[model samples]
Target: MTHSDTDTLRAIQHTERERFIASHPRSMALARDAQQHYLFGVPLHWMRDWPSPATLFVAQAQGATLTCADGVGYADFCLGDTGAMFGHSPPALAHAIGEQAARGLTCMLPATNAAVVGGLLSKTFGLPMWQMALSASDANRFVLRWARAITARPQLLVFDGCYHGAVDDTLVDMDPLTGGTLPRASVLGQVHNHAAFTRVVPFNDLPALETALKQGDVACLLAEPALTNFGLVPPDTGFWEQARALCREHGALFVCDETHTVSTALGGYARAHRLDPDFMVVGKAVAGGLPCAVYGFTHDMAERMVQAKNAAPEGHSGIGTTLAGNALTLAVLQASLEHLHTAANYAKMLDLASVLEQGLRDRIAASGRPWTVTRLGARMELQFMSHTPRNAQDVRDHAQSELEAFTHLFMLNRGVLLTPFHSMMLVSPATTLNDVAQLLAVFDELLAALRALPARPATAPASRSA
Candidate 1:
């Protein structure tokens, strides 16, 4: 981007910020009050990451719409960053939660629905045995312990720019200079070097992955089918197939984290694509927005886990939480599996996402912007570059953070909400065509605003290999 582009983006961002503050008086007041007690004026520090002038306080959310405290209604394409990918408060899940509240919340024991949920998990995700946790982060952490225990290996492999939700082993980044793993710079309170046990490689790089796995010390290769945390860099054609084969050839377990990629299909990207991971984790939307996640594994892998446990000295495993698989979560999971994670619902989501993807592409073309859209079933990302990125390096090299901030703020000012971390849009089962149209209208308005700026020559498009 040129200096003129930067100036235009700043101008638009200023106007949008002002408009947002004016429209969200209630939210602004609440944010001011919260600042007296809450850190960063928010319950979670990351909640402050939104581009809004103040944190938008939610009054209510149902289906694909969110109403802020100031009575502003937004067509929410963020969907709680995939936590509500099936849509907020789906009737079945809401009902299940209500019923379970009266029965029992948690007793540190299995609920009546536990057996049934296990069967649903096995049938839906194509894995026979399973374990539960309070979040995908916890599940991923447990799976890493199990993989290391069973395989008796010390090292783990992960793709660069991957996020498996707060797991320490997955928090390291690739050192561009030496192609070695280094602790992520943004990570705080780190006392140990994660790179000692974690090897990082670029996504879609088969040779790098094969070389890493050939070291024979890797216990598991944990990855998403498509990287989501760093702006949705998808696997190349035949990437997972070859990666899976290489892991098997080198004795590393393949653990697919489908926390976000569950939006890809009824089961997940792993099931939809038949990647056949040794272990699979599904969270976020898995329990209908409840704080629950589950990890499943093959029968052979389960047997290995049992052997590892039996061979160990009896003690706390450091593998589960008290609230995980609680009665409330189990009931909600059953309802979500029966009602939300269906082929019919997924069909609707995919159709809507297809419409959204094409709509974005068409709008980008009309605006004459060198932007691109990448879609994975119900999820889509509007990137600032012309070509789809092959890896995290591609994204970092060409990222236009200022333009991205302007786009998000612009959309929010127009009663539309996108994922704040990136220009990601998710289509839920409850997302309607009208909601999509509202987003598109705002998007078009945003493009027109950009076009009205002083003319500047377009830069050459980046090469596909870039």
Candidate 2:
């Protein structure tokens, strides 16, 4: 490692802290205004990630931009972290949802649209049978339960740093003190031992994964198509093929949670990559911002799941929700399948992602900084490390809070908004080349500002934590 690079980054962080505090008058005023009613001065706890005394209140948003309470607008590349990746209020979805809301929001009965939507899912994702839930978390929980019941296995395997939307078993990790995941105390109010059902392994490590499933107790391996939550760690070359082989060998189901990765193709990354998952869970953008998630199972697994469900007496099987597959959700899903999830939308988003990726790469390179960018179709993120990380620890270890604050705040001030927590941004179909150009201009300025700083001490000043 070169000494000069470290010095430059330190200097950048020093100036960033001071510069960030000095500006943000509008954001500061709004934060003070909001602290009166909301806990942690924000509605949701995580909104504090953006650079402000409190979270910036969003007034109005459309397509790829948001107007804050202070009346400043941002080229919103975050897109609600893929929930709005279909583009906020796309005309067809909005019209259909509005009509459905007027007709009926949720009825206990199934709608004809459900069959149509199911058919579309079958065509797009190659799954023979389908089920509905409120979110990806529910789908994962359902998948785990069904897998266990069908296989009569008691355990599951998951990769470290993989987030499947608050599924209970996924909460296990390398212990803070012991480095082996037992029941973690940080998971407040969780009464059961999650470690009893879960085995956590590092990504791209086949030996580790095989070891976990070799016991033949893991019912399934729940994972993202490519781990995106740990800041876009693409699977190592040949990682997926080996992982698939091991699952076959170990009698564990391969469940791909494409909740965040549905942006990659008309179906998802799974279909695009020819991943023949026994079960698939996707949410976030499927129903055009509605609280709906759906899952599909292969024909063989579908029969088993049906039999397992039929064996259970009706009323609270722990897998069904009243609001799931409601008339409104079905209508919205049908509309989204007809409009948003089309080939044209995928093409548009992919083109925009390429532009954003190229711009970030060029800007980062010009600054002479040792950082990298990762792209997963419409989703792109800039990570402050020279190379992509291999596992959860690598990602956490390489995290640079001061630099992240600097980058996010700098972008916020200049009318561009990235996702609050990390350098992640999703290019929506509504996003334009002009928005991309403006972001590049602003990012260029921020990089130049960082470059101008004289190297400071290695220790960076304290700031907000992610």
TM-score, each model?
Answer: 0.97, 0.91
Candidate 2, 1-466: lDDT as tens digits: 2346556656665665565445556667778887899887888777876754346677888888888777788898888878899888888988998899888888798987777888988987778799999988898888888899999998888887778877778876765454456654446689887777788888888888888889988899989978787778888888898899899999999999999888778899889988889999989898878888999998899788889888888867778788889998899899888888889988999998998899889877767777889888988889878788788767776776766777887787788888876789898889999999999999888777765553232233223232
Candidate 2 residue 433 Cα shift, in angstroms, is: 0.6
Candidate 2: pairs in clash: none
lDDT of 2 at 466: 29
Best-performing candidate as measured by lDDT = 1
Which residue window of length 10 is worst by lDDT in model 1?
457-466
Model 1 residue 293 lDDT score: 95
lDDT for predicted candidate 1 compared with the true structure: 0.90
In order, the Cα lDDT scores of the candidates are: 0.90, 0.81
Per-residue alpha-carbon lDDT of candidate 1 for residues 274-371, written as tens digits (9 for 90 to 100): 99999999998998889989999999998999999999899998889878888899999999999999999999999999999999999988777888
Candidate number of the best TM-score: 1
- What local lDDT does model 2 show for residue 438? 91
